[model samples]
Target: MIRVEHLCKRFGDLMVLKDINAEIRRGQVISIIGPSGTGKSTFLRCLNLLDQPSGGRIEIDGEDILAPKANVPALRRRMGTVFQSFNLFSHLTVLENLTIGPIRLLGKPPAQAATTGLELLRMVGLAEKAHSLPDEISGGQKQRVAIARCLSMEPEIILIDEPISALDPTMVSEVLAVIRRLARQGMTMAIVTHEMEFARDVSTRVFYLDEGLIYEEGPPERIFDHPQRQRDRDFIGKVRSLSYHVTTADYDPYALVGKIEGFCEKHLIPHRIAHAAQLLAEEVLGVLLTPLAPPRAVPTGQIVASSALAGTASTGPPLTVKVTASPAPSGPTHPDIELVLAFSEKQRSLEPRLDGAGPPGNPLETANLPDDFALNLIRHYAADIGYERVGERNRLRMRVQSIAGREAVAPIPLVRQCGAGLGGGHELDSATDGDPTEPDRFGRLARRTPATGMTPHQRLSS
Candidate 1:
């Protein structure tokens, strides 16, 4: 268990993390996300006092780690960390990577450590790659080796800092799959990532960091759908736009269903979304286009309202292109729904980033939710929103589709139900609301519990 409170870290004049507080429990996988330079790496290091917090309290189990009597190095050994850059020694083989930490740090005999080292290698599926040097393998394989090296230490928690961002698009999924596998094995992890689909699927909880503070934190469903803060919404909107790229800019800016804005710019590496999709579709459809693009645009027949009902407006466009969001519901289970929205370089008065992320006075608050309850929220939303999973076998085949028959569904889309964007995680006991007095999964009553008759929850005898 890790407990951090009022954490603040500053380098020179820049304050990277501010007033951050969170409690991470065992068997939980928490993913942190933010734009570049938002202090994600710093926070990870602070877990083991790698970068001592300027002022904050850190506790491991029940001990005050920041206390003068605590052994920082010992604490670090109890926690393992992996980086995006395969920090594996390029000159050494995979076996050497795992053995080095144990032999050197734990002062174990090389042969004895090798026994454990080989076991660790197999855990990350790299026993065959054991003799291979870092330079001789793929990025994903090298990262696997790095992970094996960390496991050799037998740590309780793993801290991964953007471990897949440096890899190419195809390789990203392979590495994420390995991490997901690790999660299944019940390793507690605190990860910093940009892979929205991966994070959404595997995370026990997610934290959105903004301006050096924890802007929002909750289950994936709450954080993704009923985001409380506008900044948080903008962060996800831009990310989803880039991942999906199919939605139109004028629709709702936040609509994200059809007709992407075509912007011309010299954006380099990690591959541009629009260009990649064009290449992938070239053999079939040449280059995809919409009325939103310039010069050689095609016009639509008649505009349709987003829904047939009245009052609610159609922030979506007419040209409905559909993509399945899947693996027959039996595939890898969690795949990212990537989308990107671009526009003409000359266009103005339209920065779609401001859509759902608009500044508002509301903040979502969801009480304690069971470990896997969020997945239910996702399935509920995905089915109704016309989001069919669209990739191949062992993949998240959910595709981007047109907004023709799509309308926000009920009991989900808490943003529409609440009239305020807030679904921070807990379920509503009644269809209309959730009582604040219920006990959390750990059997502790909420702060609002009444003094009488509520004797925690009872065990269900099967």
Candidate 2:
């Protein structure tokens, strides 16, 4: 029953809500979620004229509330707001807090307001605490009393601004339960909440605000599961990433490893999985990828680091290593890690892909590589691996396994060439040497290759 077009709110030099356009239809529950300082609360306040908009139109049931000579007080009576802090009168009893609004603002008789107030208290499950002072009840009870007070005005729409943010964690569920009941009974609500799961479950529409605008808004599933924008995805914790570029073969692998470790620690990835990620980066960059670089001669007295090779002095195409960690679909404690290696130049002629489709005299077999230590090590720690070519770039993707019990790792499958019409795949045998029982320092089974005269753990260390 409310339509906001090009709504803008500014506090001095700070622009809070900018060009916001949305409509709150009857019985629609729209949840506004975003990082703090994104003006979610300000947008809600502007709806009821608590914060005056700097520009644009706010129409309530065909009446322009922001227009000159508009009945703002009358417009607000049709909407009720529940603030983050419980704004109850400290001296008033719970029933009085609920009845005072309808009696004073709507001019209802004390007897009728009292009857309606107690019914709302009972509806919110605070009937027994009707006579309790505001200070006597817990935070959740006070918020519920505040909600009932809002309903006592008999508002057509409710604007709740982070109602449970100030409450104790144990008390949060109770307040949310009351809001959920109201939503079920077809109450129109615009909730500003940080409770991601609650918003996903209760909201018919979800708005993700960023940079002082509605960045994305859609059904809960689309907004939460498949956010179309990067900021939206990051805000909702769908995926977290760390990226680095390697131009020359002399790029600092240690610095890249440090970044990977920091990202893992920040996201609470398990120690074993984090170590696997580091190992993957080391082997993929130092071993498999370094050989693909165009051969370059080093000057006798010069050393090159990544930072020193920037701008005009850089050579060859850059390889970007992007490590993305996303929550596992199975809801495990560890997130699923995907390591993507994108080569700016296609490597069709540089290195033989693990795609096994080459002739019998392939370079991989003839190069005396000591049983392909790097590839075997990658397969041991990876749940799946694939290769694809996109335009000029050849991308290799690997999904790291959570090696707690070794059950998450699947058998090494055929590496299929995908994207850009590169088809067909070649199957590779499982790299297991029938020694899956030995645990290494990283708490994973040490795969020992007799040809290499070393275990995977020793290979990693060496």
Candidate 3:
């Protein structure tokens, strides 16, 4: 239903998109994934001529959607876009929001438009919220309503830009369910998303983009699971540029599903309950543009002291602290989420001080500075203090501190930051005795050892 040929877009000196080409078959979903700033959204916009491309062509049903004689508005009415931020009119009622497109553009009678609006609301599971206003509903609900508004026009193809990126994890399923419903009905779709799993579940084909062009294209299984290109892997790792779409075909159209399934099986990547839980939490927290450096694994029982925690001993659960990972499942995805409820963002930036940024102004004033480096204002600081480091290889151990059981003397959350190390990884071990339970601890795949089973780090200590 949609075709993009050698599409390109540039803003001033920055080239956001380049030489992009793809087709969106009716009733199939296409997702474009890549790292931040690679022009995924720009590509989507240029398809509808929302962002005039510096070059290239877009077609629908064999007609140029971007050509001058094209009925652009009519074409757009066939394509709906859902934004990361719910761009609903705050002043409009839910009913009003969905009806605006049909009544204004389709010139439908208000009563008919309203009836259709209510049906769309029901389609997206927001029929009850129709009388409510944007602010009155949660972000997830608002996005659903936004999608319903888009569907209200009964478009042939849809363009989505991070629609679920702002939703909470649990809420993400609700929105995704609605989208899945749409896909099943055979609507053509082009979506740009960082929701890796969702991209896997629904897209027909996936495109891996980098530096303004599609570096690679394959089934979602390859793009999401075993991406062939390094740039594709890095894009998915750092910030995915995934496009899972398929060319319009009349025959067996489940090509995207096969790719996703194949990749999942090869990687031993199971859709485990734990994986689902992690994805859910991510919706609550948000992902980062760049992965946070692995926290150095100080040996267990080592204490980190922050005066800030001196009084945080409320008889409750662990204070929220955000943990970050590379691949994500679904939800509003900020790289970082407010976490370790007791710890503040200021404390998280405890890298060595800049030459002159000085104390980050507020909260630190009440706590005692690390007396040793307190005077070194220009020196940035990062420490693996209590975490044990193997004598050789830095043998980085990724530290994951779940709010384990609390003791009366539970140590205050101390500050730790990664600095100046590009190639680093940490081991996650089941045994605190310095042995990783699984071979690949936190993505640090075990390196081959000689006949001896022990790592060099262990051998040296022995």
How high a TM-score does candidate 3 get?
0.52
Off by over 4 Å in 3: 237-462
TM-score of each: 0.55, 0.63, 0.52
**Local accuracy of candidate 3 as per-residue lDDT tens digits, 51-105:** 8999888888998977789998888777888888979999999999988878888
Candidate 1's residue-wise lDDT over 1-462, tens digit each?
999999999988888898889989999999998777889889998887779898889899988888999988898898999988979898888899889888989998999989898887787777887788889889888888888888889899999999987887777877787889989989999999987778899999999988888889999999977789756766776533343422332223323222332331332212234333332221111111111222222122112222334555545421121111111111112222123332222221112211111112110111111111233232222221111212321111112111221234333433222222112211221223234466432222333325532212111000
List the candidates ranked by TM-score, beginning with the highest: 2, 1, 3
lDDT of 3 at 398: 15
Q: How well does candidate 2 score on lDDT at residue 35?
A: 87
* Candidate 2 displacement at residue 133 in angstroms: 1.1
Candidate 2, residues 1-462, lDDT tens digits: the string is 889899999999999998899988999999999989999999998999999999999998899999899988888899999999989999999999988888889999999999999999999899999999999999999999999999999999999999999999999999999999999999999999999999999999999988889999999999988989757866786444566666544667778778777877676666777777777676555333333342233332122222233556435333121111111222112212233322112111111122211113222112222223455566576544555434434445555665653565444322210101011111111324346576422234445576875544233323
Local distance difference test, each candidate? 0.58, 0.69, 0.56
Stretches of model 1 off by over 4 angstroms after superposition? 239-462
lDDT of 2 at 190: 99
lDDT of 2 at 186: 97
